[model samples]
Target: MASKVTPISGFQEWLPRERIAEQYVLDTIREVFELHGFASVSTRAVEPVERLSDQGEDADKEIYAVSRLAGGDDEARLGLHFDLTVPFARYVLENSGKLTFPFRRYQIQPAWRGERPQRGRYREFIQADVDIIDAAELPGHYEAELLLVIADVFGRLPVGAYQVHVNNRKICEGFYRAIGIEDVIGTLRIVDKLDKIGEDGVASLLLAAGCSQEQADRCLALARIRTSDTSFVQQVRALGVSHPVLEEGLTHLASVMETAAEHAPGVAVADLRIARGLDYYTGTVYETMLERDPGYGSVCSGGRYDALASDGKRTYPGVGISIGVSRLLGLLIGEEGLTASRETPAAVLVAVNDEETRSDSIRIAAALRSRGVPTLVAPKAAKFGKQIQFADRRGIPYVWFPGAGERGGDAVKDIRSGDQVDADAASWTPPAADLHATLVTPGSSD
Candidate 1:
């Protein structure tokens, strides 16, 4: 039976050109991650439903439950993981004995969420995550290091003018407690909506959540504190609230900002309102925003979780940040028309002059490929113009015509400029820029 074709609202599928662009981004991320000494790891897509539900912040409501379509009875409940962190925690617990302490790993995978889809949100999406985990104790320096890692990745990509907003749960918890608000997590959950809901809205929600009007106003004031450097410590002090936890948070955040300034200046900001809604976050939290489009929401976010993974006798503490690959690409490729130099990786298409000499074309392609040039033979022996058109349509810059030169050797044409020159398949090389697919954005020179 023929199946009906339709576009799923939240499922993202890209064309050949867009896929090439995405692969370029993914490759860049993997390269940077490996260069920083993060080992790659992957976990199963489905986790136990109870495990998924146990994650805080209403995560259970968005979990996609999985059940056998044709099974007898007594099957365990399972669900597609909504995010990588939960599964990673479980992995740490299961492999605690086999793995070494202070493990540094990178995981790039797709996660499913059954929440409402929006401009940059999808039901299924790819998240590239880097985390450093240690048994019992994780260094505060790792929090600052993770920020630098993100900065390194963004610097290598075309993501323009972004900042990693850093905050600490201790900051929010201590501030709330100082103001006599007992439900720190619940209050943070409401305050996390400050961006979605304005100050007045958050105030109302806070008041409704058992906070006095004075307390709600104070919370809003704290959420509004944002600074580009360690000056935020003084600013928080000026709020006139004092607590041991708040003091501890201020010292930690200052160290993070100071280290970031020395290493990755202008890329880190101390934004107190970034209370990552997840309940697991115990200390540092991060949310990244592209200055060009802050309304697009955080393209990368994560934080420190001290007790998310514990096996009664031991605890694994870690810090991680996730880049929303699908969300970022959806904005760049789908909305802004970003793409790759060509649909295929081939930089030079070896033209097939005639069916009898097709073997010659294949041999030429092999020679060029052997020399590290991406080369492909034309599929059919058509007119030179038609063959060239095929290459042009796919953005293939150079096309090789066998026996077209005066010496009956070979000639390559730069389709963009209509320049053809005699060349040898064994020695000819495409320009470095043309060797692989290059990204083409709105402002790109290509």
Candidate 2:
């Protein structure tokens, strides 16, 4: 036997309750994506190495190469995908001929990264993503749509308040160029670290990139103006939008904010400073943060790219958002206050009256299942008390006890309130609320 168990760094597992929270996030993602007309699809976890090559050096390094035993070789060029977008782009390219234009998809799966994990960052994590790919140029309204849907996802969750940090690479670059900073693309790389390295570190890098203190401070100040409202448009104007590029960025942000507010009221806002650390995005970028928990950072973030994917013929301009499912679930589950109703699917467990009469219990279970209830039967003909304990452990609140005689055939118990009554197996109804899994209400303290 091995001397001890091995625990890998930067990876975590979920216990039952934690798994329930994770499942809740996944379920809500599917619901919201479908409600917005996005069809669901998933791509293989591994992809050709070239697929994710369009990312930054940091993102590229995070690609966890597949093991040699898994068909990887010195000549083989494939790695586990680090994010949903890259494989999605490849999926679109390889199957473009078959797919309809303006393809909308939602993917929920685990992604691997070889990174130094921190508070909410992980090496092996699950991401929930939704994207819209268009054959022609996608309007900025789609950008707002991406943020609106994702914001609504977390907004509906039990997590505390969150704001979608909105920005445009166009706006940031325009503002940079307008402010006379050369190599705007190179400068954005350094400034993206403002959250990690601090203003002083970014300023030093800006100086290294030949930005003057005035220009550096202005760029830093611009990145700092996040809002969930249209106030940033006014703020950017005060920053002097004389440069046409900065003005364009300003107008684009105003348009996105206006559309989001109208369609998904109060869901998005303009923050001139949301530099989405990726090079591909030429337009709007979004990052959502839990209002009171910056420690968890942006639970969802993505941006728009005009030409990130194309077949050298038609361009597929795209915009998307990804929610760090495992991370957000991690924050909510053991949060000392968050709660989920069920750990298993059984809404009601049918009690066994006697070992000789196991068929009676199975009959009762079928009755509940017919009523669209999830019912679990005892493994063996156990005592009534044993079945109740089993249901209680799994948090299956309602237990049905088969009656002794013909007229008194079915009786049920609500384990939570300890309420019991004789009712027919065919038509007896569990309380409306107890009929299905109950999601904890937002900001609930149970």
Among all windows of 10 consecutive residues in model 1, the one with the lowest summed lDDT is 67-76
- Over all chains combined, what TM-score does candidate 1 have? 0.97
Candidate 1 lDDT, 1-446, residue by residue in tens: 99999788998899998999999999999999999999999999999999889877789999998987995568889999999998999999999999987999999999999999989999999999999999989989999999999999999988889999999999999999998999999999999998998998999998888899899988988988999888888888999999999998998999999999999999999999999888999999999999999999999999999999988899999999999999999888989999998999999999998999899999999999888898888998999899999999998999999998879889999999999999988888988999998999887766
lDDT against true structure, model 2: 0.79
lDDT of each: 0.93, 0.79
Cα lDDT, model 2, residue 286:
84
Itemize residue pairs with steric clashes in candidate 2.
223-273
Q: How far out, in Å, is residue 259 in model 2?
A: 2.2
Give the worst 10-residue stretch by lDDT in candidate 2.
Answer: 437-446
In candidate 2, which residue ranges exceed 4 Å CA deviation? 70-74, 226-231, 264-266, 440-446
- Residue 267 of model 1: what lDDT? 91
Error of 1 at 112 (Å): 0.7
